[model samples]
Target: MDDASDDLPGVMRVVRGHLTETYADLIDVGDLDRRPPQVRDLSFLSRALAAQAVRILTECSAPEAAAAVTDGEGDHGIDAIAVSPNGSDIWFVQAKWSDRGRAVLGEDGALKLVAGLRRLANRHYDGVNVKINRQLTRIDEALSSPRCTVHLVAALAGGGEVTFQAEQRLTRVGQEFGFDGRTPVKVHTLGLADFHTFARLHAAPGPVQITATLTQGWHTVHTPYLAFAGSVPAGEAAAWFEAHGPHLLAPALRNTRSDRIDQAIVEQLVEEPENFWYYSNGVTLMCDSVQAQFFGRRLQGEPARLELGNARLINGARTLAAVAHAVAQHPATAEQALVPLRVICVDNAPEGFLSQLSAMPQSDSHTDLLDQVAADPQQLRIREEFAAELGKQYVFKRGAPPPAPSAGCTVQEAALALACAHRDVSLSAHTSAGLEHLFRPSPAGAYNRLFGQTPPGRQIWAVVQAHRLVQNALADIARTESPWRREVMDHGDLLISHLAFQSIGLEDIEDWVHSAQQDPDWAKQWTGDIVRSLAAAVTDRYGQSVFLASVFTDASKCRVLAEIVSRASATGNQESTANTVAPARRRRNSISVLVDHGRIPDGTRLIYRPGSPPEEAAIGDWLHENPRRYLATWVNDRQRPLIWEADQQAYSPTGLIMHIWREAGWGEAPVAVQGPARWFLPGEGTLADLAGELVRAAALDGGA
Candidate 1:
């Protein structure tokens, strides 16, 4: 539905239209056929809504999202389940699509959701129907991981909260699963506004074809392909992005960035249009062919009119998106900007040249490293092995789109898995510091240590899956640990993965798969105890004051920490260490000190990031439904420090945060919060982090 369709009938009409058009083939019809004919469409609509929720929350492609639906009879109230590609997120959706735009999760629905949660949590897949049963193995593995967070998505068609009774039931569920920090179950009530946002994001646009004027144009003739270099008006470039959206980019390059544009690039364009041409890297376009119309003879005198055939912005997609947003927001200022343009005709290009052009711009060390690894004879063999044995796509190219998580993985992902699986904990520790460090060009570097033996494709995939499970399990336990202990658990993800690999003894990589199938809980069962012991052991050895980043980055330090963990686990003395880690000493509040010292620049824009996971879960959906909700500007005043963009009201940071929480319907939110910690300067850390630096600097100077 368009923005103008605000009435109940229009929204419902849109929803109904989608049932037949977008989801007719995808949604399961078996159960709908059994329902009364009058209610069948409504039932389908509800199932469609569940799939939509999966798409929006997990950011999966439509077919994948639709496949997540398990809304037939005996589904236990869960309509769909979607796990993120990285295995960090898991979602369970229960949708209610109402014709009157007044859908509500009533007591019955709430009870059903609760029952489904319990069943899924306790591995009671035997009671679920075949649709859900088919996915029990993957679901079981996801649930067993402590790191993966579960979300209960209540996708209602109405513009209201779930009923009070339903809220109470969900609150009880939250307290049961969420309070423990392990297996945190977040509840999301996605209403009409939220659905509208998701629909907008999910809209698909066709291929883009634009007629552009290129000034001061130059062409190359001796090249294997025809190429033109010129400058295009920023306004024209912006219009292309405005019309085509991500279609402006080549298919493989789309969806690379979360935002429509990079905010920093937008700011630069808007703030310094005259400098844009100098600062920007310009855009590269690949087309089937180009027809240029030039008045008279000289390319320099008159502008050339070009029709770019099947053109795609292969590079600088973010730049074009930034220009579009900037021009929309500040037309007069952004109108002055100019963008350099390069158009290549792929029709006459030599074989393999297109892929070369695509990856040419991304030639950094990591990209180079991946290229080298991909060129290796062993990696080529592994790719074939994966195809022959596992029927998976093994992507190794730098700019190539990654396959779906279930389909396969990229070379970079494989390296990380190998790092974690190495018997030497230092490899995993080095990875925690930076992935490139593993690929450093040395004979004895982590690269040779991991891939030197040319492990089989099955082994690589198995280790990756195991590493994901270990990472998730550690995250779940870390949330409930003491502040110091939690830090170790959070940073020691790869280290724990290494420990699990050593202990599980993957003599055969398929052993992990066999064991996992036999006991899905093996990951959590084995890793949870190890992580707890490791967290305590690290703190005991290094003390709480030790810089965690430094410690994790150093191989020797991580080796010592790993030994301590292994020793503690073997001795059954995990809890023997005295809890000497103290809470951080109180200092002047960062915001107050920053304001009193006149440290922050006035008028600087601030972004509101949720201070905690719970806080994010509480209001993230609400904030996402409207962009203005999370935007604010900093001011000099200590008392009322922020000007919230939504209402243009000046409020103290905490007051603004509370106001947003209340407005978002988080009625049970705590009364007090450290709000400065939630707001951040663009490209800088949180306000608290910024202020803490100043305080630390002053202290180092003896309070001078």
Candidate 2:
């Protein structure tokens, strides 16, 4: 088959942007610095493929902060690996960057990837480097579980087909590891053509297989498009959006808008879902083709359902989100909430009109918008006023594309920072939460108090960058054989860093940020200060590997870590004392323990304590019975125990009484029973005690 040269420019554009955004710094491009600087051009085959693999890891899979660049020597023929959100699915990507642009993976090339997968699945990781071996260890662990599904992928920059023979070879490799056809490893062969299709789908996901009730019997109506008008249950609408996340808004790296509208839409869905058909502007679905099957009319006095295949949603992301929200709130009621939809099947490509559809306004939302708290004139004034103070743009709606990276500080960043820093946590939320506003409709004070009385956005962009620097630093630290490797949370740690960046013992941190923004010299010194602080933190607690463990496990400790870092920065120690995460502890006890009191700094209390009732056997039974009772209440009453805050992307300690008290809002904690009084005093125990406390907390959350 002949490869078309025409697709190169567009495909490469997505590829290029993907490369730049995927990495926070040149360090992420690990071996590139070791090579001749020009080799870092990244247009080179191996590097390009590695970058693309990174894109697949983050974009196709969960946006793991761990998605890394591995184009260096000793990579073991593996470009990247993405652990699925649940840790059950793993994608081992082997990419070939062809100067001639061929996308085909011959059996020989596929064998290289297959060989590595075989080694990893078989737990033969000694052949790989330390880093790759660590990931392989995790892969091997997941493979032992019945739920694990590994994907063998061959990505190409040019056009070449993955022949049937290559796929058969991949199967044989999986079979060697006991993966039969029933639980066979999934295989994907992608070239530039597929990348283009993927890009388009990402821009607007389609052929989503939606089911709805036809407003009228469908006859092929074909002038503008082969079309059908219908009604869909809000639950089904929610399903579609959840299934096609980010694809529905492809090309946008993250949903970085600052508008509180999804809640209102959901309110309408719950309160007057019957009027949803009337008040709704209806969803527009684009598909390459569609087929509908009648599921019979309902005797429940509503429209009958028609199952439609290959429906891609183009114009109703907000509605989809709202439906998802409504369904989340009232599942039974959401089953009853029907929404209007228009399904259009087009043989022609859809890129041309999708953006136009996205721009088109749905009128009913306007009525709700009028009633929104953010829409109140005073809140509008505050938004405008805050925007003016920051000398930035004031965005007015949800789903508005984020301002360009160089377009100064964004409201979303400001709001997210406020939410993490302020008392009003529920004010601003991730787009997935669908309520996005902390700066407007609430207190101008959240913004005002960012610097403890001034809008932090003035210097926030720098702080955000500093936050990223700290995260990248932590990631670098975690790569070592430290016990805290699995404990790093990028964004949550960033919030803690931000909290530290605020003024504390030193001059107000915001003033420093503002000053740093104005002066490059100050900025450099400030960055060095933060780096040193994190370094010292990494090395703290007598070189204990769990030094910054609390930063990830406890939100309160996250705040404490911030203060620790800030104080270090204030000390003006230009050199970092904590260079690497400390080695694992030498355990002296089977039970939990913490660092010695003499070694532990002031304001730092022992977090891990193991002395409980001596009846260990009965305690096990007690834990087994109604195990999730505590998990349910502390994590969630209805939803699965959210051991991690999805929006915050941070871990929580399930067994910790204070964390449970705060997360579950279960009144005040029984301080005497679960307080500092029970801590393992200085020299009372070895660091072994802290280990089980952290491990148990993590296990509790994981089980929950």
Indicate which candidate wins on lDDT.
1
lDDT of 1 at 376: 75
Q: What is the C-alpha local distance difference test score of each model?
A: 0.70, 0.47
Off by over 4 Å in 2: 1-90, 94-210, 214-231, 234-283, 287-310, 315-340, 345-380, 383-497, 501-531, 535-704
Give per-residue CA lDDT, model 1, range 23-137, as digits (tens): 7788777756667865776777788888888766665677887899989778999989887654545788899887778888888898898889778765567768988988887
TM-score of each candidate?
0.43, 0.35
Give the 10-residue window scoring lowest on summed lDDT in candidate 2.
Answer: 632-641
For residues 1-704, write the lDDT of model 2, one tens digit per residue.
01233355766656544434434343245545567644555434455455455454346432342344344566677777766544555677777765345657778777788777666654466657654755665665555433455677787877747767777887675445434323336777667766556554544444456566554433345576677665767777777767765454423322321112355567667887777776566677665666555455533223455455555555666677778877877887566777877766666647777556545444333323324433445335535654665555544345556665455434455445444433222222121122232332212113222322223233344344444444445555445423332233322344434433343211123334344445544444444344445445644622322212222323343444555665664575434322211222322222222222223333322333323432122233543453442321112111111232223221223224234334444221221121222334355442334445656676899999
